[model samples]
Every structure is written in structure tokens, then in C-alpha cells.
Target chain A: MTAANGNVRLAARSLAPAVLVMGKGGVGKTTVAAALATLEAETHGLAVLVEFGDGESGRRALGPTHKGVEHVVIHAAEAIQRGATPLFGSATMAKLALGNFAMRPLLKAAPAIRELAMLESVRQIVEARPGVRVVVDMPATGHAVAWLRTAKQGREFLGSGPMFELCDRVARELVAPGRASIIVVTLPERLVLEETLELCESIALDPGLEVARIVVNRVPLPLAQECLVDARALAQGGGALAQPAAALVSLLEARAAASAGAVAALEVFAHGPHAIWQVPLAPVDPSARDVARWLRAEGAA
Target chain B: MKDPRVIVCAGGGGVGKTTTSAALSVALAARGYRTLIVTIDPARRLAGAMGVPITDVVTPVPLPAARGRLWALMPDPRRSMGTFLDFLFADEPEAKARMLTNNLYLGLADAAAGVHELVAMNLVARAATEGDFDVVVIDTAPSRHAIDFVTYPARLAALLGGRTVAWLAGLAQRSGGATATAPRGLLSWGTGHVEHLLARVTGPNLVRDTANLFADLALVRERFVALTRRASELLLGERVAYALVAAPTAAARDDVLFLAARLEKLGRRPRAIVLNRADTQAAPWVRALREGHGVAPSITEVLDVLEQERRTRATAADALAVELRSKLSWAAVVRLPYVEASAPEDIVAALSTELDAHLTALLPDAR
Candidate 1:
């Protein structure tokens, strides 16, 4: 790659055992998570792609999983049941309580139940599958924050119960350095970048949960200044190409200006150990293999 | 054609729903209608786009050029439950005091996604009633389950209005915070067994707190019911309009379809589908350059790449529009060109102008 490409080489050790891919909606969190899972599974022994909520995006992006990679969709209700089965001391009793109609609304309305359950489910998977990298496709920005903080909230709420112990275990795992890290994905747009910076600040407030990397997706390729000058000159020469040339110049100029602003913002925000990577704009949606190939070509492994 | 007093912009994240909501509100205000834009997203995007500081309180937006006035209510998610409680318990100070101090309630306030959504809807209801706005635009959260918040009002009302809550409240009253002992009542046979199982799973402390919280809430159940009823009416009313925002990407298309299906299942159809950034503005220009004699060889490679990218984007967008049109024939599908502005305000202003032209089609009676 040319020096102009500016792709950072991420060491393999930098990849945490648990990588939570998060960002604003529509910023390709699923794509990044899937790609990361594919890369990890191929490089390492096995990797699990974990998806929250509906969980279809991760599977769709990953497509048919190759050997050594697994996909699992986690729903709150099922997670809660799994968590309760151990707590209640019997599977049948857990089912009875959860199945009770009177308990349904109460459980649904209870605060942090979904978040705690999801974390508990993840904790179980990590505990059960040793030496497996877990890549989570987290929810959008706002809810994802809540999900990350659920362990703390659960401990405070439950105080001294079996559930509180579960929360403690999950919280410890999350705060363990080099064990869990966050990969924030964002676009190069002005507003998206601002939101991403704010999200990073919020995440930093939680100690031990590191912002390992920031991947700026869909950054347009920089156009040569001389080419733009030539286009402007061509536009000034009034002809059929004038309007088209002017439009092209304006479009390219606007895009370049926007990209420059994003670059400047990232420069100001760049600090500490977390690296910021930029993925150039692609013509179509990238598959997991494509992303893995791109990262490998960049020497990110 | 009837004019909608409420417009709800719903879609997945990063589809420009907040920007579209702000622009639509600006356009509505420009057309001489007093408008209030309420954003449920905690991301502060609307505030950034409008260049105004928005909080839980309704703040007037200084749209000096518009014929009518504009206001915004962007509730802080952290403080939404508190604000909502203050509103719900405006008259019942004792109940509010009790519930605020309750550990369960405190936990709920911190981690309850449902509370934030309900609080946002409640704030919108309060704004519409108290502000005397001609139209209110709601910018929903960026999630497939964003539409699920529409059911929160009814679901909460039902939960609070149910006999179970009354029984729980009665149990708390009899037991006086001691949930370990069973209180004898008509519903004891069924509830006693369920309570035992619940306590086994969630612990006695949680059960006690739940009972205490319900008892405090029982004092203001009537007000909660009334507030939720009003919010539900405003959301599910005939004059409410649903606008689904989408981009050209396959992810955005799926989000739009999913949201549309969710809305349809709720018996509310989308009134308009906003295809944001669905067109390449320079496509025609690039086509002309390719078709005509491009005498400049220096920029030939750049032009070729631009033309190919434009064709790819155009083809994808065209296919998306066709599929959406066929799937949702009832909703008016409006395409918004990609605004070539970097600043958030500039983008909003440009899209507002575009939306102004298509407002009538989107909102049939928008004059």
C-alpha cells in the first residue's frame, strides 16, 4: 500500500478476547463485528459472533460461516430463562416462574432485567467456551451504553442475591484489562463523528473497558488538487462539459472538504493507545471475507 | 385530504431520521404552522443540527425567518424518568416522595429503556397539550424496536390498571414492607404460589421492593392512566402521521421494511417513506460528460470512476425504490437527494428546502 493510504497495522495481541463492536445505527457495526470474527477465527482457533436484539444482521453479514467460526443470536427472554434456571435451582421452577402470567409484566417492566440477562448469557458463553474469541455486535449507541453499564446497575439493584453474584462475575470480566475491549465504528460525516467522540468519552468514564480502536468507515478517497484545478478550468470554459464539469468539481470538492473536517477532528481526538483506522469508501456492501482481506492487506493482523 | 397534527419519524440508526424530523418541523413552521419537534434520541443530534441547546424542558427554537414559531423538547435520558415522575405525580407529593426513594424505582429510572421511551412520549403529549402547537414532530430512537415504544403507553396503563397491581398494592399495605409473610386474601391461593416462585428466583428483597413500589404507584394510578391515555391517543390517533426514513443501502432498506411491518402490525400505516440520500445529484452531469465529447484527458480516469460509482449507487437506489414501492403501495414514497453539505445545519437547511417542496405529498393536507 502507498504511504498515502495510511492504514495502521494492528498487532494480533491487540485483539482482545472479547471485542464489543459498537457505534451509532447504520454505521456498519455488524459488518465490522463479522469481519473481526472471521479474522479472529481464521488466525486463531475458534471465534463466536454474538448478536444482540434481532441478531439477523451479523448472520447476514457473515453469510455462511467458514470453519472455526460460530454464530449465536441472544434474546433477552431466553437469556433471562437461562439465568433463572441456575438461580432457582431447577429448570422446571425457572420455567414456572417465567411462565406465570402475573410475573410476565413485572419482569418486563423491571429495570435492567434485559441488560442483566444479556450480560449473564454472555458470561455463560465465555465461561463455557474457553479459548474462543467472542465478538459482539452491540445495539445502537444509546442502548449499548446502558447494556455496558448493566453489571453495575444490576449489582446495585439486587444487592445480595444469587443474581447479584452473577452481576459481580460479569462486571469483573468486563473490567478485566486486555480481556474485553470495545471497537467503535463511525462514519466520516460531521454529526456522526461528533456523536462518536461523545460516545467515546462516555465509554472512557468506565475504567478498564478500553476503547481499543476507532474505525472510520466509508471515507472517500482524496482527489488530487491538480485534478480539481483542471476540472475547474474545464468548467470555466463554457461548453457542454461546463455544467457537468462544474457539478463534478462541486461534488468532489464538497466531499473532500467534509473528509478534511473529519480528518482534522480525528487528529485532535487521537491520543493514548487506541488507534484510529479509516476504511475507504467501497462501491457495494462489503462481505466478511472482503473486510478480512482488506484488513489483512493493511497488515492489521 | 386531512392534515396530520402529529408526525413520527421512525427508522434504524444513521438513516438521518433526526435530521429529517428537524427539517420537516422547519418546513411545517415555514408554512405558517406552529411546530414542536420532540426527539427521543439521547444522542443530542437534533440539538447539534438545530444549533440550539435542548433539554427535558420545551425550548423555543429561534426560527426568525419562518412564518410561524418552532419549539424543541429533547429529553435527557438520564433525567427522563425523574421528569416523567414529576409530571405524573404533580399532585401526589407523598406518592412521588415514596416512589423516588424506593430502591426499585431508582434502579428502574437508571436502566429502564421503556421508561425513557414512555417519558419521551409523555413529554410530547405534554408539549402538544400545553404549547398549543399546530403540529408536533417526533424523532424516534434509532432501533428496529423503536416502534415498540408506541405500545408502552397502553402496556403500562394496562399493567397499572390491572387487578394484579391492586392485589400487590393491597398485599404491601397488609404486610407493611414485610414480603416474607403471606397475606390472606381472595387472590392469595394463586398469588401466594406465584410469589413463592418469584421470590425464589428474584430474592425477597426484590419482591418487597416491587410490592412497595407498586403501592406507591397505586396512589397515582389514575393520573398515570390518564397521562398514558392522552399519549396513546396522540400517537395512535387518526391525525398522526408516520414517516419512515431510509437511505440507499441494503441495511437501511431492511430497517425501513421492518419498521413498516411493525407499524402495520400495530394497525398504523406509514403515511410517507422518506428515501434520504437515495439519488446521486451529479449522476446526470457525469452521464452527459461520458456521452458527450470529454475533451480533457487529464481528468478522464476521475470522471470514469465517478460515473461508475454514480451508476452503481443509482442502480441500487432505483432497485430499492421499486421494491419499497411494490411492498408499500399505500405510502407516498418521496426521494430526497443527497445534500452536499458538510455542516449539520447546512444539511438540515438543504433537506428542509427539499422537504418543503414535497411536504404536500408527504402530508396530504400540508398547505
Candidate 2:
């Protein structure tokens, strides 16, 4: 393994118990979560990859199954059922309450109920399994923020009830240092960079919820400045190669410029406190193993 | 021939659906059709692309060169539910006031995904019917399940119009004034046990507050039903058109197919499948470089890597287009070139120019 790989391995050794990967849609959240889970499992002996929506993303990223890792899809309805059983004092009573047509929709329509149940379910999983590290691939930005804020909203709405207690437990665990950390993934495009900056600012507002890392995915490698100068000279010569050479140079230059701008923006936002990692653009869609390997190489670089 | 009254753009995240929606509206407005583009994305990307601030109010887009006018409505998701409730309870000020301040109602309005989407659509329906516009273009949220929002209004209308809500509201009215007493009736008999179980789990205060909220909502049930019905019709009617936006990645292909299936299940089909950034390869340039000799190795090395990446991306896009064409033969597949601009407005303008050429294919009567 290279020095970068060694550095990534060292960084992977100090992860929190639960890592929530969040970002805008199509920003490689699933890929990062899967790679983190793989790395954590290698060190911890076992890790759980949690998916909130359909389970297809986890399977696609990890290729169905991997050693030392387990994939769990948390559905809100099932989570509500599991969480309410103990509170209702009987499984049958929980089922009856959830099964009623009038009550089911009402509960479903209630704000933060689904989000609270999902978070509570994750808390239960972590408590039930002491040694396994958990990695969650969160949904889009809007829904992810809603899920994070559910605890506070639920507490205010339901002041003193079993649901309130559940919310408090989830909220405490989320804010506990070294218990859960959020990793925000983003791309190097203009709009994506702005959104990433905004997301980091929002995450910073919450006192205890740590922004563990800022990962810039799909960044292109910077080309040598002399190459661009040479290509520009060739373009001015008016040869057949001049046009294609110039096109190639401009494309590369544009991508490199965008990557540089994104990195600079991240640097200003991070201000030497937050960790910023850049993942080079892969030739094709990468799997969990590919990303883990890339992480290692990136760390050494 | 008449233009489609409603145009819905559906796709996965980061595929340029918002840009496409904005461009489409720009193109339509240029053709002398007054258009309003409504975006349900909480990211508020339309404002960036259009270079205008959009709120819940319909704001005019300054398109001085266009033959007709352009407008936009980007409702804040947090406030949409309250705005919708205000509109629903416009006739009864007291009920509206109570419902607005109700804890349960406030909680439901804050983060309910279904309510946010429903209210956004309701706003679209209101704009389409009440505003003076030739066509309404909708930019849906970036998710496979975003299509599900089209069904929410109908489902909610059915739920509220049923006897269950009425009975629950009645129960709340009877319980609020006096001590709880069991009533002997067929509907109440079965629901009484369910209510007891629900109260036990969610707490009695929650049940009472929820029931009271519904009781207030029941005052305008007919108006709610009418609004939802109109929204459903505008979304799912024959005059509505669906445009599926996609990119050239494997994931985008899967997302397009998934969205197509969902639309199909809803008895609808995309009128046009827009392939954004499909033409990324500079083939003539690559061929010329390959034939030329006496080039610097530095330039050659950079060109070689970029050419490979471009070829791979182009090939993937071609393969995706072919597969989608074969699978969804009914929809017209349109390709949009990758714009090299960096600014959001520049990208939107370039895309709008590209879309201007395919208006007829996207909307058959758009000419």
C-alpha cells in the first residue's frame, strides 16, 4: 500500500460509533457511506450500513453483500411498530393502535412521528449491538435536515409522553460527542459548491452535532500550466491538431478551474478546523471497494 | 391545436431538472405563451437559475425580449402548509385562527413531506386556474418518489371526504364540551376501541388535539375536496404533459427507468425524455489530434486522458439513449448538449436556446 493508503487507514481508526453521511442528491452519499462502512468494519470487526429509503442503493454500492458488514433498511412504519411495542406494554396493543385506519393515517400525518421513529430505531439498533459501528446513507438535503431536527420538534410538541422520552434519547445520542458525526459530501460544480457551503453553515448552528469531514467527490486532476500554454500556442498556429488540442485544453482547464474554486471555497469555510478531503474523478462508476481504495490514496496525497 | 395546460418535469437529483423547467418556460414564453414556472425543490434553485428572487407570491420574470410574459412561484416548504391552510379556511376566520395556532397542526405543517408536496401542488393548481397564464410548468423535487406527490391530493381528498374523519371530528366535539361517554352506534363501536388504543399510545392530549384540529378542518371539507380535485385534474388530466430529465450516468439511467415505471403505474407517460449533457464527446477534435504528429508530449498526455473520459461518457450516453428508446418507444427522446458555462444563469440561458429548437417535439402544439 502507498503512503496515502496508510494515512487513510490511520484516519479510519478514529471514527465515531455512528456516522451519518448526508448531502444533496447525486453527490455520492451512498458511495461514501458504503466505503466508510467497509473501512470501519475492517477495523471494528463488524459494521452496519443503514439505509432509509429503498435498500437498492446499499446493495448497488456494496454489491449485494460484503464480509464484516451488514446492510439494514429502516422503514418508518416498521420502526414505529417496533418502537411502540414496549411503550404500549403489549405487542398486540401496538399492532391494534397502528392497524386502525383512522389512527394509522393520523399518526402518519403527525409531524416528526415518522422521523422520530426512524431515529429511535437507529438508537435501538446501536444500543442492542454494542460493538458494531453504524453508517447511515441519508436521503436528500431537505429530508435529511428534517430528520435531524425531528428530535427537537417532537420534544416541543409532545412534552411528557413515551414519544417525548424516545425523542429525548435520540436527541441526546445525536449531540453526544464521539457518538455520532455527520460527513457532508459534495461535488466541484458551481451550484453544488454554494449548496455545500450553505449546508456546512447550517450544520454548524447545532452545537453538539459535529461536522466530522467535508468530502469533495469527483474532482478532476489539475493539469500542468505549461501544457495549457503549449496548447494555446498550437491553437494559434491554425493546424488540424490546433482545434482539437485547444478543445482538449479548454475542457481540462475548465474542470481544473472548477475544482480549484471549490477547494478554495471549502478552505475558506473550513478555516483550518474542518477536515477537507478530495476524491479524484473515477473513470467509471465506483463500488465500495474502489472508493475505500481511493480514500486511502487520497489521504496519502 | 392547443398547448398543454400543465407541464411537469420529473427526474432524479443533480440531473438539471430545475434548469430544464426554467428553460422550457423561457422557450414557451418566447413563443408568445404567458408561462408560470413553479419549482417544488426546497433548494430554491430556480431563483439562482432565473436570476430573480421567488417567494410564495407569483413574481414576474423580466424577459424583455420575449413576446409574452414569464412568472415564477417557488414556495418555501416550511410556510406552504400554513399558506394552504389559510386558503382553505379563508371563509371562517375563527376556525382558521384556531387551526393555525393548534400544536398538532403546527407540528404536522412543519415537516410532513406529504403535506409540503400537496400544498405546493395546490398552489400550482391555484396559479393555473386563477392566474392569467397560458401554461403552467412544474419542477418537481429531486427523487424517484417525487412523482408520488401527484397522487397525494387525490388520496388526501378521499381520506378527508370519508366517514372516518367525520366520526373522529364528531368525537372531538362531543369530548371537548363534557366528560367522555360511550355512544352506541355501529361506526363508533369499532372506532371507540381504536381511539382508546391510540390515546393510550400517543397520550390523551395528542389524540384530543389531533381530533380537535380535524374538527376545525371539517368546517371546510367541501372546499378542501374541491381544491384537491382541481389540483389532481390539472396534474393527471389529458392536457398535462410529463417531461423526464436525465443525465448519462448508469445511476441516471436507472432513475429514469424507475420514474418511468412510476409514471406508467399512475396511468401517465412522459411526453419527452430529455437527455441532458448527452453530447460530451468532441469527436472531430479527437480524430484530428490522433492524425496529427509532432505535438508536445505534455499536451498529448492531457488530450489522451480527456479523450478517453469523453469517449466513455459519450458511449454511455448513447447506450442509455438507445435502451430508453427501445423500452419507452412512445415518448420522444431529445438530446441536450453539455453547456460549458460556469454560472447558473449562463447554463440556463444556453439550455433555453437548445430547448427552443425542440419545442414542437416536447409539446406537440407548442408551435
Which of the numbered candidates is closest to the native, going by highest TM-score? 2
> After superposition on all CA atoms, what RMSD does each candidate show versus the true structure?
3.9, 3.4
Q: What do the candidate models score in CA lDDT, each in turn?
A: 0.76, 0.76
lDDT of 2 by residue, B173-282 (tens): 55465656675553556677766665555565666777777777778878877776665686788888899999887677889999999989999999999998777555
Tell me each candidate's TM-score.
0.88, 0.89
Query: In model 2, how well does chain A match by TM-score?
Result: 0.90
**Where in model 2 is the C-alpha error above 4 Å?**
A1-6, A206-208, A231-253, A268-274, B1-4, B27-35, B57-71, B114-135, B166-177, B186-193, B280-300
- Clashes in model 2: which pairs? A4-A300
The runs of at least 3 residues in candidate 1 whose Cα sits more than 4 Å from the true structure, single-residue gaps closed, are: A1-10, A231-250, A257-274, A299-301, B1-4, B29-34, B56-71, B126-134, B163-182, B190-194, B197-202, B280-301
DockQ values per model:
0.51, 0.50
